[model samples]
Structure formats: C-alpha cells, structure tokens
Target: MTAAPTHASLDPSGFESRHFGIDDIFYSRTDGRGIILAANAVFQRVSVYDWSDLIGAPHNVIRHPDMPRGVFHLMWSILGDGKPFCGYIKNKAEDGSHYWVLAVACPLEDGFLSVRIKPGTEMFRQAQQIYTDLRHRERNENLPPEASSDALLQAFESAGYSDYASFMTKALTEETKHRDIALQRPADWRLRSILSIKEGVKEIEDHAGDVVRIFKQTNQIPYNMRLQAGRLEGTDGPISVISNNHRQMTQSLADAVATFSEKSLLGNDYLIQAEFLHGVSRVQHDLLQSFGLEPVIDGQDKAQEKALLSRQQMEFVSMAHKAVVEVSDRVSAFSKICNDVRRLKAGLEMTRVMCKIERSRIAERVDGLDEIVQQLGKAQTDLDHLLSKMDGAVQQILEAAERLTQSRQRAA
Candidate 1:
C-alpha cells in the first residue's frame, strides 16, 4: 500500500459542512455547458438557493472551491462522449457551507440529469484525499486540468481499479451498498446471485485457459510417437497405427474445444455490465421512493419544480427499466453457452479415453510416452471439473436474471 496523501489544506474544520438526511438524494438537470435547467426540492433545500437563484444559473453556482477542477474536467470529457459520470463531489451552499454527494450524472434528451446521494464509503474517503492531492498540485505546480485528470486516473489504478470506467463501476456499487446498509435494506437476491456468477466466471475462465495450454502440449505427443515408430520398425509398426489414431481423436476434441473461448462461454461480457446496470436500476427505484416522501410544495413556482421532478423520476425509471432488460437478456445468453460447454465437456471425456487406449499399447518407455498421457489426463480432469461448476453457476445466474426481468415492470 502507498502512503496516504496529505490533506493539510483540505480539512473540513470551519467549513460549516451542511448535513442532510441519509435518505436525501439531490436531483438536477443541466445544459451542455452546465447551466442549471431544473432541480428537485431537495437540491434547492440543501444548496440554500431558491428556485430563482438556481435555475438558469451556471450549474457551478454551488461548486465548492475544494473540489478539484480536474474532476470537472474529467467529467466533461466523459459527458462529451455522451457517457454517464459517477463520482464523489463536494458542493457549496449559498452561505458557503458545504456538502458531499456521490453524484451520478446521466445523459438526458438534449441535456443531462444528475441524481446525487450522500456518500458513506471508504472509497469516498479515498476520493477526498485524491481531490486534495490534485488541488495541491494545481496550486503549486500549476497543473492543467487535463494533466491532473491523467494523474487522477493513475491514482485510481493505484487504488485497485483498472481505469476510470472500472473505478466508477466499483465506486457506484460500493456507494449503493453502503447506503443500503445505512437504510437497513437487505442486499437484493438478484444482485448477490449476479455477483457470485461474475466471480465464478473469472475462475472458470482461468481454468479454461489452462486447458487450452495443456491441450497444445499434447500436439507433440503424436509426432513424437511417429518418430519412435520409424526408429523401431518403420511406418508398419503398432506405434505408428496408435499415433495416427491418437491424432484423429485429439484433432476432433481440439476442434470441439477451439469452437469456444472464455468470451464465448460468457457471451461477450462476464456480467459486470449487467451487475452495474441492474444495480443502477435498483438504486434509482429506491431514489424515486425517497423523492415521493418529501413534502409537497406550495405555490405555482415551487409546484413547477416538483412537477419537473415527477417527470424526471418517471423518465429515469423508464430508461432504467429498458437498460436492465437489455443486460438481463445478455445474462440469459450465458446459460445457453453453459449448456454448449457441457456437451463439449462430454467430448473431452471421450478424447481422454481414446488417448488412454493408445497409451496402453505402447508398452516400451519411448521418450516417456506415458508422461504425455498423464499430463493430458490431469488437464482434462481439471477442465471437466471447472465446466461442471460453471453449469451450476450459469443456472443460478439465469434464475436471478429471470427474477429481475419478471419484476422489472412492477418495480418500475
């Protein structure tokens, strides 16, 4: 582990950080350049800015100085590509007080919509340190936003993420899980099953790679036997016949095995995308419930903010439902792939038997012919075991996906 970054200048003391309910989720909309378009009552209340002060103002009206410019720079770069941005951000109230949120900014029609939740994860604490480190660099070294963003990504990698996208996926899941714990909500069965399947797929894929490598090693065995046959009694020898037979059987098995890869078995992705998107939909559903619990606004003006919120919530829900269905379909595809792998595993068993028969005839220890058979036997056994485990995992994953697909409509 690396040493913790200093936060000497990023301390929250005398900062008058405002506290919001654990259930509170701030919602807002912004134009391409980040001018505020619409916001929910919670956003208005927490920022201490009235509708008049917030609407049409730059969305940065509440941006806290402590927030690194590089974060916004990174955000715009991602949003420019029409992708969503999820990260922890600090914001300021009109009275100069501050608050933090795990903001998920998603693309909307002609603009963007952001839903924010109060963050309570170890990742959030790490984010604060990174922000402080970047801010310090900007102050002392005059680091540009883009350069700082590159450095930020390296920091994310150091923190165990592969890249920004991976970091955000992990960060979003952690934030959602922590929030659920705080709210005393049990982890959803579908999510748990999906996560388990993801882990199982990784293990299965690794073992599958070993199978391919081991199978490649068998390619030399037949050639070696033919060489020995030539030395002992020319092409007419029993060793030569056994070598030809082994080649035919091994080729057939290799063809069956080569028709697939870890990618094929998992259907393009290992359910990581589905896990995150399903998580997104589930968390958004909870947010909608929270949105409904706020006091109804008075007057036509506040009423309009509430009206916008209602429409945004519905629109977000519709989008979430659509996304979940697509990901679930891909998840179900893995089940079919698993069935195909099971049939292939049977082929592997047949190949192993044929090789064993050939090895039985070669009584002479010709270049350790038995060793080749021994290695093949072990590799086949390992692959078969992994495939058997995959069958069970895929079944569980399919059941979980079905549960979500069936309930998505009612939940939406």
Candidate 2:
C-alpha cells in the first residue's frame, strides 16, 4: 500500500469550498487495503482528478486536514470487521478545495464500494462541531488518535446514540431524508419528483389489488344466499321470500363492489399518467434552468408565454388530483356497501334462527334445510371477514390520499 500523506505535505489554505450538486452521487471501489481501484465520473469530477491519477492511490488522498483522525480510525475499525460504515466526511479536492459528504462504505466480496452524497442536514452540522472539537483535542493536548476516538464515542453518547453504529445509521438516514426534501425545492427540482409520483402510483396499484381480492370473496356471498333461498322455497312460506330478498340484495352489493373496484383500477391508470407528467415537468424545468438567458423586450414576452404554457400543463395534474378524490369517494361508498352487506347477513342469521324454531314442522318437507342454514352461517362469517379487509384497505387509501394532497400543497 502507498504511504498515507503527511499533514505538512498536503496544502490546506487559499482555496474555496467546492460543492457537489444535489443530484450528484460519487462512487468508488477500493481494495481491501484501501487503495482506490475504480472511480465513477462524479467521483472524478468532484475530486478534480483524472482516472489515471486516482486509480491505485490510497482512498485517503482526498482526506481533508480539518477532519479528525479519530473518525477515520473508527471507520477503518468497522470496515475491518467486514461491516459497512457511514459518517460525515470532509474531503479535499485535488486543488485543496474541500467538500462535505455523507459517505457510506460497504464491504464487498473482493473490495469495498463507497458511495458519497452531499450532506445538508442538521445532523451534519452537529457532526462538524464534534469533529472540530476532536481535532482541537488532538492538536492542543497532543492526544493520540485513539484518545480522540474515545472522545468521539462520548460525544455520540451525549447526543443520545448508544454507540457508533447507531449514530452512523441515524446520520445516514437523516441525511437521505433531508436530501429528498431538498430535491423538491425550486432550485433542486429534478427526477426526484418523478420518483415520488411513481411511488404514489405503486401505492394505488397495491390498494387496487386489495379491492380485487375482496370482490372475488364477495362473489361467493350472493351465490350462497341464492342456494339457501332455493332450499327453503316451497316449505317455509314467508321465510323463503325473506331469503330471496336477501339473495337479491347481496347480489346487488356484489355488483356495486365490482364497479368500485373498476374505478380503483382506473384511478391507478390516472396515477401512472401523473407520474409521466411529473417526469415531463422535471425535464422542462431543468431545460429552463439550463438555458434561460437574460431577458430583453421580446425575450421577456417569450418567457411569459412559457410560463403560461407551464400553467396550462398543470391542468393535467389538477385532473389527476380530481381522479384521486373520486377514487377516495368510491372507497367510502364501498365501505358503506360493506355495512349494508353486514346488515343483510344479520337478517339471514335471523332467518336461520326461525328455521330452527320451526324445525319439527318442516323437517320432513325440507330436504336440505340444515345444510342451507350451515351455508348461511358460513357465508356470514366470510362476509364479515371481507368487510374487515375492505375497511382496512379503505383506511390505507385515505391515508395515502392525504399524504399526496399534502405533498401537492408543498409543491405549490
């Protein structure tokens, strides 16, 4: 392995901070000994180095003087155990400019894959203070790097993390959440909006699948009710009529639920269209950012025209939101239908009880009265099960709709 660079040998002053874009991710692979093996375009771009200069160099070639040595010691200790390590890192560019990243290093079969992204979180700020204090301890007190590592653990404990592992995990998670929120802002708007809409579409598809399942289960209810009615037709007088009425009511309920499920499927299609339109909007916004020139008299008019066109495109999104509201209404309606089915099942139970009371009178006349009663009981249980599932699915759909509405509000 190549020797680590000394503090005096590396330049530390005169350069401004270089920044990686929110959309940029730097990736590199290092050997087991921490020598760089391969680097991606973003990695090379941010480091201000060519592939030839970076390849085979120690990964710490970009380590900044401001970073505490204890942090690297902890990272290496974790990596030695073949575990992934995540932390906030200050890395020096080839020209001595520095940038901050939330770095995740995962141990691989033959080497390690380290991915880094721009960090703009509160946790990152806390990390900066901790690193600065550790560096101070090392420089002022002449503390060893291992002693600085102990100070790092104390800092994490003081911050409520039980250990380095938990601290790093929370840091990475918070950084990612902050990065996603940043992407939704005007300056950083890009493919992240498209990705978020796609996730919303997936939620719709999942709810639609649940609706299809309940519909299939619901079909059995009407069929069972009709069979029960057929068995009691001639012997039980008005009881047979009550059973037939229930059969028709259940059949109508089944048909209504089927229609509602179709609407949910249609809603899924609308969500997919929304995802596509979000992608288009991201592209248009990125183009505007990339090539927007200074406004002259006629140029300002063109810009206004473009703004008008963008507003018109938002009508598509408005239509998509309307579709979402319709699906939510359908779910509410289906929930009410489930309640009606439950009421009908209760009536069937009462009919079953009456049949039991007149058992001696109709025993010889009705061939399958016992079997029909048993079937009715089983159908009631099945209906209850399906109603429960429908209620849960509707709750999920409502929650998802609220979240989408809030996201749109934020976007506006």
Candidate 3:
C-alpha cells in the first residue's frame, strides 16, 4: 500500500509559494492520515488561516460544528479503499457563516481530490434533520460528538440508502428538475373548449409525476400542492396558474350546467351531463381553494344562477306551448264566425224566396246579407290557411325537441 504524503512544512506567510494558482474553489489534498499535504490560495482564504498555519493541520480544520463526524469517517472508508464518495456537507467559512455543498471527494495513491457545488434547499433541510438526530444520540450515549457520524451513517443505511455515493446521487438528481420548468400548455385541442381544460389537467398531472419522482430520489418530504399557499406572490408560477385557471373553468362549467332546461327530457339529460362536468369543476375548485385562491363561483351566485336558469327554461317552454294553444283558439274563433255568417245567409236566402210572393224590399235585405257572407268566406279561408301553417310550425318544434333529446342522451 502507498504511504500517505507528508504534511507541507511551510511558514504561514509563504502559502502562496507552496500552493498557488489553483482555480477559484478552495482546493486541498490530504494524505491517508488526514494531514494536509497541499492547499491553494483559495484554501488558505477559506480556512481563515495562512498556508503555514494550515499546511500541517488536519483537513478537519474547516469542519463546521453542525457537520456529523461519522460522515467523514464513512467518507474515509470509501476513499481509503481507493473509491469515490459523494455527500452533502456543511463547511464553515472564515467569517463564521456556513455554506452547504454537495461534495465529491476521491482518493489517490498520494492524496485525495475533492470537488463541490452549492447544495439545494431541500437537501439542506433533510441534512439538518439527520444531523440533529445524530446530535441527540451522541448526547444520550455520551459518545464523542464526532462519533455521532457513525449514527448518521447507520440511520442512512437503515433508511435503505446503499452507500454515501447512492445517497448523494439521489439528492443531486432530485434537485435537477424543477416542476414548473417542465409545464407547457398542451396542443391538439381540436377547437373543443372542454378538451382544452382536459389538456391543462393533463399537464398538471405530468407535473405531479415529476414531484413524485423527486420524492423517490430524495426520500425527503414531497411537495403537497394543497399546502403551498404563497406560490402566486411573484410572477404566476405553475401552481398559481393551476389555482386560478382551475377556478375559472369551474365557474364556467357551473354556468353552462345551469342553462339546461328542466321541462324537456333532452334538456334534462343535458343537465345530467352538466352535472358530471360540474363534479370535475368542484374537485378542481376545492383543490385550488385549499391553496388559498378565491373560487370563481361563489356559493350564492352558483345557487341563484342554477335556480334562475331552470325557472327561465321552464317559462320559455311553457310560453311556446301556450302560443300553440292560442293559435288553435284563433282558428276556433274564426270557424264560429263563419258558422254564424252561413246561418244568416241560409235565413236570408229563404226570406228572399218567400219575398218572390211578397215585396222586393226583403230581397234587397237578403242581397246585403249575401255581400256580408262573401266577405266572411274570404276571411275564414285566410284564417284557416294561417292555422294550417301554425300546425306545421308546431310539428317542427316537436321534431326539434325530439332531436335535441336524442343528442343529449348520447352525450350523457
């Protein structure tokens, strides 16, 4: 086995000579024994100590109090065996401010190579929970605080993370996709408004899948959309669109449902379809409301609109049927007038014949009656023709009603 490199023997002020010109990151190489063999200028800056002060010191000099030592112990186990290891780590800075990093560290024959990046918020939160638990165990067991790192590793293992590498992979992967970034309005709406709403729902479902995938990767607390209330504070986020648009769709569907007429069987079937649509709206509205958005349909407006629409539809149908009845009555009235004129004509004709044996004055009266009868005949014919056209109109209305009923039944 290769022996660990000796610590860099140098004066504090001469750090620039021993470790110089590394990249912007804090760079360091530590031997098998944890001795710092080399450090770049950035490392000196981060450690809050000059090169001379840091060179011979253990690499643990910058370790923050909140970091579990067991993580390092496990990290070393893999690296000491010439393997790569990665983890989320907390590192203290010269200014006492701490930063979280997702660290990838490797072991070489001579020393170790480490690289890191900023950790995600969710990762930091989970790490905090784990480290806190480790701290409690350390206190209860009276073990050295650093020894709690073992407890953390055990906890992670118990939770089924195969190793530090796997855990880090999951954490990094979880942070990769932002749910809202993947959302897009669906295409192929086919000019159907309802289909468009359905497409939006599909997009939301896809986003929800992303959320679930992230949770599987991290084992962290998954997002609860119902609980995310402040998502609209900025430019509208995905959740904001969902909440607002969903409410709008709900109100629209409710209004459409209310427009169905109650008297027509076909209209009633349309109402049933509307009810199904309304159910979808209700569920969506409830979800959005849970996230603190105002619903598009208020309680009173929904109730009043539904009742008013039903009443209006019934009134409209009743008025149409009443019109049919009024036309029939007009026909009957015209017939009665014709019948009275006919009777008068018959009486006048008889009187005129009898006048042949009497005066010509009675014959003149019969002539006047004949003219009245002629006008009544013309008027009766016109009225009858108008009544016949009205009957045809009534037939058309009934046919329309039948067709509408069939269509609604199919839709239902």
Candidate 4:
C-alpha cells in the first residue's frame, strides 16, 4: 500500500476544470488503507494518469484541493464500519484539471470497489456550494477535518436533510434520473427516448407549485366579485346583468383553476415515481458495468449466471422505460390543461376589460365601481403572470416530448 499524503504536502494551485463526457464511467479499486490498487481505462483517461502512476498511489492522490477535508473524514468513518458511501466528489487530475463525479464506494472482498459518473442535477450544485463553505471554514477558522465534519452535518440538517445518508441518497437519485435521459448512447440506449424528461418533470413540478399559488389567489377572486355583485343587486338594465355575468365567470374560472391544481398534483406524483425508477435503473447499469463480465464464457455455470443477470437487467430496463412513458403521458395531459388555463385567463381578462369600460361610462353614478374594477384588474394581472410561467413550463415539457419521439424514430 502507498503512503497517504500529508496535508502540508498536497498542492492546491494552477488547476482548471476538465470536463468528461456524460456517458463516461470511471471505476477503481482501493486497498483497505486507501491505496489505489487498480483502475479502469475510463478512470485513467479522466485522471490523465498512467496505470503505473495510479496503481500504487494513495487514493487521495486524485483528491481536489477544493473539496472539503471534512467530506473525506466522513467517508473514512463510514468505510471503517464496512458501510458504503455515496457522494458528489470533485477530483484533480495529474495535469491539474478538475472534474466532478457522483461516486459510490462499497467494501469488496479484500478492499473496496468504487464507481463514479458525471453529476448533472440541481442537488449536485447545492452539494458543491456546501463543500465550498465547508472548505472555507476549514481554512479560515483553522478547523480540523473532524470539526469541519460536524459543521457539514449541521449545514445538511439546516437544509432539512435528516442526515448525510438521506442527502446523498436523494441527490444521487435525482442525478441518476437526469443522467439516464440525457446520457443515452446509440450502443447502450437504455431510456434513450427520455432525454430531457427529467428536466421537464422539474419544470412541471415548478409549474404545479405556481398553480397552487394562483389557485389560492384565484379562489379569492370569486368571493370579491360576489361582494361587488351584491352592491349592484338593486340596480337595473345591462349593468346588473353584467355584474351577475361577471360573478358567474369568476366562479367558473376559479373552478377551472382548482381542477388545474389537482391535475398538476397528480402529474407531480407520477414524476416522482418516474424519478425513482430511473434511479434504480442507473444503479443496475452501474452494477452491470462494474462486474465487467467476460464476453467469451469458458464455463457452463458462469455462462448460465451471466445469462440470468442479463435477463434480470433487461426486465429492469423495460420497467424503467414504462415508468418514463407514464411520466410522459402525465406531463402531456398536464401541459394541455395549462394551455386551456392560459386561454381561460385570456377570456377572463377580456371580460374584465369590458367591465372596466362600462364602469368608466358610469363613473359618477357608481361610488365603489372603480375600486372593484381595479381589484379585478389586479387579479387578472396576477393570473396572467401565473399563466405565463405555466406556458413556459409546458413548452419545456412539449419540447422534451418531441425530442424523445425523435430519438425513438431514429432508433427504429
């Protein structure tokens, strides 16, 4: 085993970001003492190091200076208990270029096997910020790695994560969902048609949240309109008729908005299921690749075992694709509802504008009519804003769906 580098011996200068392709997966095995024992071709390529340089070096040889020492301390503590650790890691290459990976390390027969892939999720970005803060504390406060680890845990807790494991699991799951769709290749096109679907789900989730907010605001619109209608209850002619019609329109709009909220919630639930399935598929893919099964089997039992595993993987892939299809269907429905809401909002705005014009004609006769008109106008403005946001989100979903269809056609 190689000796671990002392903190003072590690350099932290002259490095730039080095990006690897999304499909690249790096694998390495480390001794119990944290010395690199072996690495795959992808690992060598990304690290810009020869096999000779890596094989006997301490695993931390690739550790980037920007990474918090606290993270490593926590990893070692977990590994000591024979538990696997998963995290977003920033690593340095031999040529002083850095890259980020979502890495999982598990105890193997004699040591540990680690597999890593590019991270492409919002949580990864959050993790990066957290790491930067922890690194800053370690340097500025002259804190030891162990002390920084405590701070790191506190930060995670403050961010609403129950523990490090919870945070890592959620982050990894989300990243996997995004990468599954975005990183599909012609040779290994598992979930190939789902490109950008994860992003679309995120968009829909955001839109749903906006819908909930708009519903709350629109819910009040009818109540206010009813109050105004009561003020004009004793009036005669088209004015009274218009007031009644306005109240009716507002109530109908409110009901439509409520229905939209319900549909968005349902769509969001389906998306969560899709994300879970994608995460499982990613784990299966990584496990299959890490095993590095031989193409030419020499024994009957080994061939049988391989075939069984392949069949299982195929089943998993099919299930994951089905989940993606379900998500696409839900998002399509959700997008259609959003479009209807946009048109409904436009109609509401047109009616409100006509009401204002009529109120202007009787400005001297109606004391509070202007105030009512102003309130309705404000409500219309809020609805328009919400609908605009939803439209953008729906467009994103449609574009992703189109891309998925195109990919399938190409594959066929």
Per-candidate TM equals 0.83, 0.44, 0.35, 0.51
Q: Candidate 2: which stretches are off by over 4 Å?
A: 1-16, 185-412
Q: After superposition, how far is residue 411 of candidate 3 from its true place, in Å?
A: 61
Candidate-wise lDDT, in order: 0.70, 0.62, 0.43, 0.66
Best by lDDT: 1
Q: Of 2 and 3, which scores higher on TM-score?
A: 2
Error of 1 at 25 (Å): 1.8
TM-score of 4: 0.51
CA error at residue 17 for candidate 4, angstroms:
26
Model 4 residue 264 lDDT score: 73
RMSD versus native structure for model 3:
34.9
Sort order, lDDT high to low: 1, 4, 2, 3
- The sequence of per-residue lDDT tens digits that candidate 4 reaches over residues 197-259 is 656566666766765675465445545555555666545544566656656665667766777
Model 3 poorest 10 in a row by lDDT: 260-269
| Residue pairs in collision within model 3 | 12-52, 70-149
Model 2 per-residue lDDT tens digits across residues 244-277: 6655665666665566555444254444444433
lDDT of 3 by residue, 48-144 (tens): 6766667778877767766656777778777767655667776665555555655656565667755443444465556656765665555558766
In model 4, which regions exceed 4 Å deviation?
1-159, 162-196, 208-233, 252-254, 266-276, 279-302, 339-343, 363-367, 402-412
- How far out, in Å, is residue 356 in model 4? 2.1
| Candidate closest to the true structure, highest TM-score | 1
